[model samples]
Target: MSSYSAPLRDIRFTLFDLLDVESSFARLGFDEAGRDLVDPMLDEAARFAGTVLAPLNKAGDEHGVRYDKDSGSVTTAPGFAEAYRQFTEGGWSGLSAPAEFGGMGLPHVVGMPLEEMINSANLAWGNFPLLSHGAANALQHHGEDWQREVFLGKLVTGEWTGTMCLTEPHCGTDLGLLKTRAEPAADGAYSITGTKIFITAGEHDLTPNIVHLVLARLPDAPAGSKGISLFVVPKFKVGRDGAVGERNAVRCGAVEHKMGIHGSATCVMNFDGAQGWLVGQPHRGLMAMFTMMNTARLGVGLQGLGLAERALQNALRYARERLQSRSLSGPKYPDRPADPIIVQPDVRRMLLTCKALVEGGRALGYHAGLQVDLAAHAGSEEERRQADDLLGFLTPIVKGCLTEWGVECTYHALQCFGGHGYIAEHGMEQLARDARITTLYEGTTGIQALDLMGRKTMQLQGAGLKVFLGMVQAFCEQQAGNAALAEFVGPLAEKAREWQGLTMAIAKRAAGDPEEIGAAAHDYLFYSGYMVLAYWWARSVAAAEASSQPQAFRDAKRETARFYFARILPRTLAHKAAIETGPAPLLALDEAAFDA
Candidate 1:
């Protein structure tokens, strides 16, 4: 069975050392979120995750959840309910939620590392509380005052759970094509009727109720994406007195037997005149739901990171112990019959790849989390806007690159174990299976690429891109005289210029041929991601050098950063080349000619 330790040191390094999160939080007016308060919480979370949650992970995967066909209810894998009880009792459910809503009111940056630990410990069980974060966020931002007053506190305190019910059988990516109906009902309530597919945490016994943020259309609403509206539908109705009432019209038709995360209930939900309340203005549900979807997208990226981190830990531990053929040069462990695989150059290559990606990815992901706080709590309006813009630019890059890298790193870690990695005994394959869904969910990588290329960069005229480029140029200029960073700063400066020029090149081509954007979108996203990783890797090296950290730690960071720059960053060349090729290669062939 696989095991997990929270990688607490690395997380601390990312937050306190690299990002200076304490000062960042202080400046953002988070008085109680300093290291003195947050450090103990981290320790407690680590203990809970390692001792309680990690032990349940393998069994959770093997046992999965028990779905009662008769009752339309889901019983989570063994120990999941008790763990969630402790999770809520520990106040982890509301770690970053607003204080007035029964939350700890900590900074979002603080919650991110906790998220990483929970997910790494047990991704399936983590799903139990996952959507509550997004649910509370949506309610806090866009829900009616009465709606927030009724629902937000329960969600924050984990007295209940939540879900995002967006997909239908006929619609996955195209929300505009959804046919769920919401009719006018008494007391400003909505009568919702439709079927929603692939609803994560849709129906479970872990909590008293499940809050569903569903998208539907009204009778007079416009056709297509414009008419969509969001609703808060509960499995068991809640009365105005804050008491649980009779069952609503929503029921889980079936639970999907999935490739992975079987402990998570991916349910097919049927809502037959369920009583829901409108969240925001009519015909503007999609806008409100973006509040939830964006939160979910970032959470999914953290899932990828957490899974990869666990996979790497097990692979590294196994590599050092698993004896194999002698090293080509000579056996380092000649005292034994054979050498551990770590001595082999090729094995080292795979490990280094995992290290570079996972560590580099932690930097990128946490920085994005910090940006989330900056966007919300920064001192000045311009600073907040700039931060928000930078965050928008970084979101797709973090989600797309981290998830894709999660898949890549997991496979490499599995490969490091050779055939044993393929077996269920070691738990590597479980991680590989779990990692598969991250890329597919919360918007697929292709969808993220298109979002980045089409909307954020093109329609908005690269506002976020400009903000990020400014950071890159400023960092490069500040470090120009530092000889240790000269290697990275010079190339980084050049890449920043090339990135701007590449954007201009694509814009020019896209203006003439609209298909150019779609053609270049995927490559452009990966290209942007590689460049972004390069920036974080460089900053990591700088942070390592400037810290009073141990020599070994500093050296590891420098070496991994060097490895990233030398080996991985060059992938951008291929992406850039593909982006330059335009639409002909992708669109040239006739649709009917494929089979021929």
Candidate 2:
């Protein structure tokens, strides 16, 4: 059976040591988020994740979700419903939500590690809350006061679940081509008619009711994306008094039989004149939905990080136990029949790659999470703006790079198991399968790359990049005089300069030809991701040197940092070259000529 243990120590290190989250709490004026409360929450979350969710992962994968055509409902894998019960009872659904709305009102930074732990334990099961978090974010930001009172409380308290219904059969990322229609109703609500596909937790048995945040166009609206509007369509009509009423017109047509995350109910939702209330002003849906989508993107990045951590943990265990051919130089474990696979150079490479990527990623992801807390709670308007800018810039990279690396880490992790990894019993293959979707959903890596290089950088004129560069420069300058940090400071400073120079060059090239943006976009994103990660790695090394933690823990951090700089960071060189190459070679091949 597959196994998972929450990396609580590492998580604490990332939050309390590397990021200094205590100061963040003080700055945000979250008086309730003292060490006494945060530590217990983290400890309990880890225990729940390990004991309740991890065991069900394999069973969930094997049994999957059962869809009943006649009933138009879904039954999740066995134990999933009960586990969700415990999850809600624990008040995890509202961990980061407002206290007035029946939530704990914890810092978003604190929620990040809890989320990572839950996802690591069981990603498919984690989908239930992940969707709720996104849905609550949308409603909290754009919903009318009455709507929040009616819907947001339940979503926060885990009494009901939420889903974002956007993708239809005809379109995925392009919201403009959506054919869903919303007609005006005499009751002051709208009648929604649309078939939204690939809705996560769209129709499930986990809750008493499901709240769907849908996107549809009004009858009098203009064409394309500008015409779209947001709506709150509940499975059962919710009265103003919070009473669950009669069934709505919404129904599940079918649940997708996908390659992975099978325990998650990816459903085809049909709203046949379903009653829905408008979320924001008419024809301004995308603007509001972004509040949810952006949050989901960051959560998805954590999903990647969680999966990689699990993969690395399992691989490390197997590598030390499984004996194979003797080491090339000599057997490291002379007492063994041959030697443990950990002695193999390639095995170490794979394991260390996973290590460097995952730990480096943890630091970056948590820092982004901290930025979220800062943006929401910082006192000064300028502080909030800068935090918002940095958070916006890092979102796509965190989502894209971390998910992509999640895939790569799983590949290496499975390889460490050798032929046994492919077998279902070993559970390595399942991780690989589960990780494949992180890149596809919330927005594909390509879409994220475009958002980073095109919208975030080029369109915003690099305002976010300027803020990030300044942070990196400041970190480098702070560590310049410390002899222990000499190895990292010089290299980090150089990468920061190269990063700025690369962005300027891309901007200049795109000025000449806009198509150049798309061409260089993907590479530039990876380059940016590597540079950001490089900074975090260096910072981690500096932190490790100063920390009074056990020597082994500190050594691990330093070794991982050294590996990242020595191995992973050089990847920027290739991306830099590819970005400079521009769109010519990519556009050279004609569509028809290539096929012939």
Candidate 3:
């Protein structure tokens, strides 16, 4: 059986000691809910995650979800309904929802860590409610007065779940090719008729109704992405009296048989003249969708983080208990036939790499969460704009780099367990399988790369990049003289410089020849990702040095940062070389050359 125990100590350390999360809340005018409230909330969240949700993960995977074609309803795995009941009963679904909509109004800084724990415990179960948050975000951003009043409270309270409907059979990435139709109907509503595929949490029995934030084209809409519009299509139509009325013309055609996260119901949804309300102005659906998409991108990155943490835990537990060969110096456990594998340096390296990435990812995620809060609640407009600009620049990097590192970290963790890791019982293999989608969905790494190189860097004329580099440069300057961090800081500074130079080079090349951007996108994404991680690691080391913690803990932080720069961060060199090479080799290849 797979079990999860939230790393509460680590969570506390990251929030208070490392990042000073309380001070961040204070800065955002949230002092009334200080550490006293924050601490207990986190404790309860961790308890729920470890006790209720974690145990269901393996069972859910084993049982999975079953679809009834006749009834058009999907039955979730055993214990899921009860788990969701407990989850909503505890008000978790409303942790960060707006107060006016029956929520606690907690900021992302507080909500994010809780999200990590829930995801780490059971991603499949966590996903059911996670989508609601995304849907609520979109609605709050672009919804009408009645739309907010009618849907927001129920969504916040988990009375109904939500989903984003963008992908179709023929269109996954390119929305311009989407054929879903949204025609204006009587009574000022739109009639949405389309087939959306890979819709997670699209249809489930856990809630009474599922709200789908769908994208479709109007009858007189222009072609391409500009023609798209967002609509809110509920499974059960609501009457004017705030009661369920008619069963809408929406149904789940089928559910996908996926590689992992089997418990999460991915449905092929069919909309047959479903009644839906327009979210934003016509030809502006992509803009409305981005509100949810950006949040989903970050949420997916955390999925990678959660899976990596699970993989590392399983590997470390096995390494410590499993006896194998003797240690290099001698047999430490002579009583046993051999020695535990953790005594080996290679195993330690693998474990440390996973640890470093997870911890560093936590810092990166928290920083981004803080940015989100600042952007929303900053005292001055200028302060909010700066925070928004910086966060916008890093969002792709956070989503792209963290998820990529997540796969790598999980793979390494699986390797640490040797053959046992491949077995189904250990659950490490499942982590790798589940982590795979993090890179694919919510935008592929290639897409993220293009977004970073083509859109983020070049589109803004390097305004975002300049803001990011300035922050990094300031951090480097502040930490340059720290005796304990000098070694880590120097290399990180160099990597940042290299990253900046590479960004400029790619930008210049992309300006002259647009083809160069495609060729360099992936490499540029990797290079940028490494630089961000390196910078984060260095900042973490500085914080560790300033802490009053035990020497062993501090030493581990410093050592892990060193390992990141030496072993992991150096991969950027290859990526940089590839980026500098531009579109020559990639474009030069003939069409037949790819026939293999």
lDDT (10s digit) by residue, model 1, range 2-114: 88999988898888888899888889999888888978888999999999999999988999988898999888888999999999999999999988999988889899989
**Which pairs, if any, clash in model 1?**
none
lDDT of 3 by residue, 348-464 (tens): 888988988888888777787778888999999988988888788778887887788789887998898788778887887777877887888888988998888788888877666
Q: What's model 3's overall lDDT?
A: 0.86
Candidate 2 lDDT score at position 379: 99
Where is model 3 more than 4 Å wrong at Cα?
A: none
Q: In model 1, which runs have C-alpha deviations exceeding 4 angstroms?
A: none
| lDDT at 347, model 2 | 96
Q: How well does each candidate superpose onto the true structure, as a TM-score?
A: 0.99, 0.99, 0.97
Backbone clashes, each candidate:
0, 0, 0
Model 3 steric clash pairs: none
TM-score of 3: 0.97
Per-candidate RMSD, Å: 0.9, 0.8, 1.4
What's the lDDT for residue 391 in model 3?
80
Worst 10 residues of 1 by lDDT: 236-245
